[model samples]
Target chain A: MVTLGHFLLFSGLLMAVGLYGVLTRRNLIAVLMSVEILLNAAALAFASAAAFREPHLFAGQIFALFIIVVAAAELSIGFAILLNVYRTHGAVTDDAISEMRG
Target chain B: MSLTAFYALAAFTLVFAVFAVTTANMVRAAFSLAITFFLIAGLYLLLGSPALAAIQFMVNASAIPIMTLFIIMMTRSRSSGAPRTWQIAAGLLAAAAALVFFKGAVGHHDGQINPVSPELLGSNLLQAALLPFEVASVLLLLAMVGAIALARRRSG
Candidate 1:
C-alpha cells in the first residue's frame, strides 16, 4: 500500500534538502530554488492529507495551487531584484548583497 | 497498494530534488527544481488532486522555473554556489526540524490509503477559491512588473 507515511517521509526528505540548499547557497537564484523545493514539499504533505481525509479535499488542493502561484510570483520578483543587484555590483553573492548588514 | 509505483514516483521526486539542490550550476539547479516540481505534481495526482497537479504543472513547472532560467540567461551570471557554511548548517538544522514536525503531524504510523481515485477530483478547486485566486494572480503580475523594474537600468 502507498501509505501516508511514505509521502510524509519523502516530503520530509525533500524539505530537508531544500532547507540545506537555502541555508548553504550563496547565489540568490539558488536560494530561490531552495524555496521552491520547500514549497513543493508543503504541497505534497497537504495533498496526501487531503487524499486520506474526505472526497471533497479540494480545499487543500486549491490552497496548494495558490501557494504555487504565489511562489512563481515571488521567484519572478526575487530574480528581478537579483538581476538588478548583479547589474550594479557585478556579483550576486548572498552575503555581499546586504546593505543593512551594519 | 501499488507500492512499487508509489515508491518509484516519490523516489524520482526525491532524487531529482537532491540533484537540483546540490548541483553547483545555477541553470542545472533550475532544471532540477523544475523536474522536482513536475514529479511532485505527480504526487498530487496520486493524492487525488488532479487540479493541484495541473496547477503545479502550469505554475511551478512551467511559468515559474522557466522565469528563473530566463533570468539566469539574461544575467549570464558567472557566479556559482549558495551561501557560506553557517547558512547551510542553519538550513539543514531547520529542515531537520521541519521533518520532525511533519513526522509528528502525520502521526506515528502510515495509514492504508486508497490510491484509486475518482475522476472529478478537485475539478472545482479553482472555482471555489476564485477570489483568492484572483488576488494571487494580481500578486504574480505585480511580481513580474517588479522584476522587470529591478532589472532595468536607471538613466543618468
Candidate 2:
C-alpha cells in the first residue's frame, strides 16, 4: 500500500538531494538546476497532499500548477541574468561574479 | 502493482537526480535532469493526477531541460569543477537538516486516491482559481518581455 507517508518520505529525500546540490555546486547554472530539483520536490509534496488530504481535491493541484508557472518565470529571468553575467564576467561560476564583495 | 512501480520509479528518480547534480559535464547533467523530471511525472501518475503528470512532463521534463541545455551551450559552461571539501561538508549538513525538517510530515493518513480528471481541473481553474490564472498569464507575459529585454544585444 502506497501511503501518504511514503510520498512524504520520497519528497523529503528529493529535498535533501536538491539542498545538497544547491549548497555544494559552484556553477551558477548547476545551482539553478538544484533549485529546480528543490521546486520539484515541493510540487510533489503539494500534489501528494492534494491527492491524499486536501479538503478541496483540486487545491493542491492548483498550488502545484502555480508553482510550475512561477518556476518557469523564475528560470527565464534567472537564465537571462546569468547570460548577462557571463557576458560581463566571461564565466558562470559563483567565484566569477564577485564584484559586489567588499 | 503501483507500490513496486513507485519504489522503482522513485529509486531511478533519485539516481538520475544525483547524477544530474554530481556530473561534471553540463550536457550530461541536463539530460539527467530531464530523465529525473520524466520519472517524477510517473510518480504524479501514481498519485492519481494525470493532468498534473502531463503538465509536469511538458514543462519540467521537456521545456526546462531544453532551456537549460541552451543556456549551457550559449555560456560554454561545458563542465563544472568539483565541490570543495568544505562545501561538501556544508552540503551534507544542509541535506541532513532538510531531512529532519520534513520528518514531521510523515504521519499516517488513510485517504483514498481520487483520480483528478482534466475537466475537473479545468473547471476548478476557471471557477475558483480564475483570478490567479489570469494573474499567472500576466506574469508569464511579463517574464517573456523581461527575458527578451535582459538577454537581447544592445547598441553601445
Candidate 3:
C-alpha cells in the first residue's frame, strides 16, 4: 500500500528538480516554468496529506483548488511580464534584464 | 495492481519533471511540463480526489501549457546552448539544498486516510472558505485586467 512517506518523497524530489531549474536556467520563461513545477509539488503534498491523514475533511482539496486558481493568475501575469520584457529588453534571458540591479 | 500503477505514475512524473527543467528547447520543456501535470493528475485520481485531478488536468495540463507555448511563440526566446559548467554546479547545489531541507522539515506521519466527497468539498468552500473563494474570483479578474494592461501595445 502507498503511504504518506511515498507521496512526501515524491513531492520533495519534484521540488528539488524545480529548484535546480530555477537556479540554472537563464531564460526568464524557463524560470517561470520552474515556478509552476514548484507550485504543483506543493499541491501534491497538500492533496496527499489530506487524502491519507485527514481524509474526511475537504480542507486539503479546497486548498489545492485555491492553489490551482492562484497558479493560473500567476501564469497570466508572468506571461504578460514576459511579453513586456521581450518588448523592452530585446531578449528574455535573466541576464538581459539588469536595469534594477544596483 | 494499484500499487504498481502508483509507482509507474510516480516514475513518470519525476522523469517528465526532470525533462521539463533540463531540456534545451523551451517548447519541449513546456510539453514535458504538460506531461508532468497529466501524470500528477493521475496520481491525484489514485489518491481518491477526482475533483482535484480534474482541476489539475484542466488548468495545469491544458491552459498553462498553451499559454506558455503562446508566450514562447511571441517572444521567440530560443536557447539551444548547453548549460555552462558553473550553472550545472549551481543547479546541483540547489537540488541538494532542497532535498536536505525537505528531509529536515517533514517527519513521520501517523494520520488516517479518509476519502472525502465532492459535495463536502463544495459545502466547505461555500460555508467555511467563503471569503477566500470570493477573493480568488476578484483576484482572477484583477489579474486579467493587469495582463491586458501589461501586454498592450504602446502607441507612441
Candidate 4:
C-alpha cells in the first residue's frame, strides 16, 4: 500500500530536480520552465496531502487550484519580462543582462 | 491504492521532468515538460481528485507548453547550451539542500485516504474559498493586461 510518506518523498524528489534546473540553467526561458516544474511539484504535494490527510475541509486541493492560477499568472508576466529582456539584450541568457551587476 | 501503478507513474513523471530540465534542445525540453505535467495529472487522479487532474491536464499540460513553445519561437532560442562546471556543482548542492529540507518537513501520516468529489470541492469553493476565487479572477485579469502592456512595442 502506498502511504502519504511515499507521496511526500516523490514530491520532494521532483522539487529537487526542479531546484537543480533553476540553479544551473543559463537561459532565462529554461529557468522559467524549471520554475514551472517547481510549482507543479508543490501542487502535487498539496493534492496528495488533501487526499491523505485533510478530510474535512479539503483545503489542500483548493490550495492546489490557487497555486495553479498563480502559476499561470506568473508565467505570463515572466515571459513578458523575458521578451523585453530579449528585445534589449538580443539574447535570453542570464549573462546577457548584467546591467544591474555592481 | 495501487502501489505498482503509483510507482510506474512516478518514475515516468520524474524521468520526463529530468529530461525537460537537462536537455539542450529547447523544443524537446518543452515537450518533455508537457509530458511530465500530463503524467502528473494522472498522479492527481490517483490521489482521488478528478477535477484538479482535469484542470492540470488542460491548463498545465496543454496551455502552458504551447505558450512556452511560442515564446521559444518568438525569441528564436533553439538550444540553451550547457551549464558551466561551477554551475553544475552549485546545482548539485542546491538539489541536496532541497531534498534535505523537504525530507525534514514531511511528517509521518498514515490515514484513510478518501476521494474528493467535484460537488464537494465546488461547494467549498463557493462557500469557504469564495474570496480567494474572486481574487484569483482579478489577478488573472491583471496579469493579462500587464503582459500585453509590457510586451507591446514602444511607439514614438
Worst 10 residues of 2 chain A by lDDT: A48-57
Q: Give candidate 1's whole-model lDDT.
A: 0.74
Worst 10 residues of 3 chain B by lDDT: B104-113
Q: For candidate 4, what is the DockQ?
A: 0.76
Off by over 4 Å in 3: A100-102, B104-112
- Candidate 4: tens digits of C-alpha lDDT, residues B1-156: 378889999999999999999999999999999999999999998898999999999999999999999999999999997999999999999999889888854566664578999999999999999999999999999999999999998997
- The CA lDDT at A44 in model 2 is 96
TM-score of 4: 0.97
Interface RMSD of 3: 2.0
> Which residue ranges in model 2 land beyond 4 Å of their true spot?
A54-57
DockQ of 2: 0.78
lDDT of 3 by residue, B1-156 (tens): 667988999998999999989889999999999999999999999888888888899999999999999999899976534667898899999889888877843564544456666778778889988999999999999999999999999999
What value does the lDDT take at residue A38 in candidate 4?
Answer: 97
Show the colliding residue pairs in model 2: none
Q: What's the CA error at residue B115 for candidate 2, in Å?
A: 1.3
The 10 consecutive residues of candidate 4 chain B with the worst lDDT sum are: B104-113
Give the alpha carbon lDDT tens digit for every residue of A12-99 in model 2.
Answer: 9999999999988999999999999999999999999888875484999999999999999999999999999999999999899888
Which pairs clash inside model 1?
A: A23-B87, A23-B88, A24-B83, A24-B88, A25-B82, A25-B83, A26-B82, A26-B83
Steric collisions counted per model: 8, 0, 1, 0
* Ranking of models by TM-score: 2, 4, 3, 1
User: What global local distance difference test value does model 3 have?
Assistant: 0.87
Judged by whole-model lDDT over C-alpha atoms, candidate 4 comes out at 0.92
DockQ of each: 0.64, 0.78, 0.67, 0.76
Preferred candidate (DockQ higher): 1 or 3: 3
DockQ class, candidate 4: medium
Error of 3 at A20 (Å): 0.4
